[model samples]
Target: MTGAESWAREQGDAYISLVSRRAGEFYRALANEDAATFFKKPL
Candidate 1:
């Protein structure tokens, strides 16, 4: 993978670790997720 992709993967791991059912940061983190990944449908 490219450097950016690798970096994102690493960051994703960190995010997954930080995710919690008790906290609402998961939604905020998901909101910050790259739009390209969030919206992959063809327009």
Candidate 2:
């Protein structure tokens, strides 16, 4: 899959890049969370 960094560098869109990157990091962090915590919030 194309990453935010790739698109950021290619298109030079800093804002979208930041958002995409943070979204990725957020999801990655979420993956490591326990089921109880994971289900704490809605998707």
Candidate 3:
């Protein structure tokens, strides 16, 4: 791919990773009954 396309793909991957992290945190928080702490981190 072109340089610009590569950069876009990288950004997409980063976003997907972030979303996945957030979802995992949210799920864990629900399981543990600590929603406040889950929203406090990088996710």
What's each prediction's clash count? 0, 0, 0
Query: What does candidate 1's lDDT look like per residue over 1-43, in tens digits?
Result: 2465468787775432233345456545545332232224787
The prediction achieving the highest lDDT against the true structure is 2
Deviation (Å) of 35 in candidate 3: 41
What's the distance in Å from true for residue 28, model 1? 29
Across 1-43, the per-residue lDDT of candidate 3 in tens digits comes to 2465468687775311222455666745544333233345565
TM-score of each: 0.27, 0.24, 0.26
Candidate 2 lDDT score at position 43: 75
RMSD of each: 10.4, 9.4, 11.4
Which lDDT values do the candidates have, in the order given?
0.46, 0.46, 0.46
lDDT per residue as tens, model 2, 3-38: 755777798765331224235567556443222322
Task: Tell me how candidate 3 scores on lDDT.
Answer: 0.46
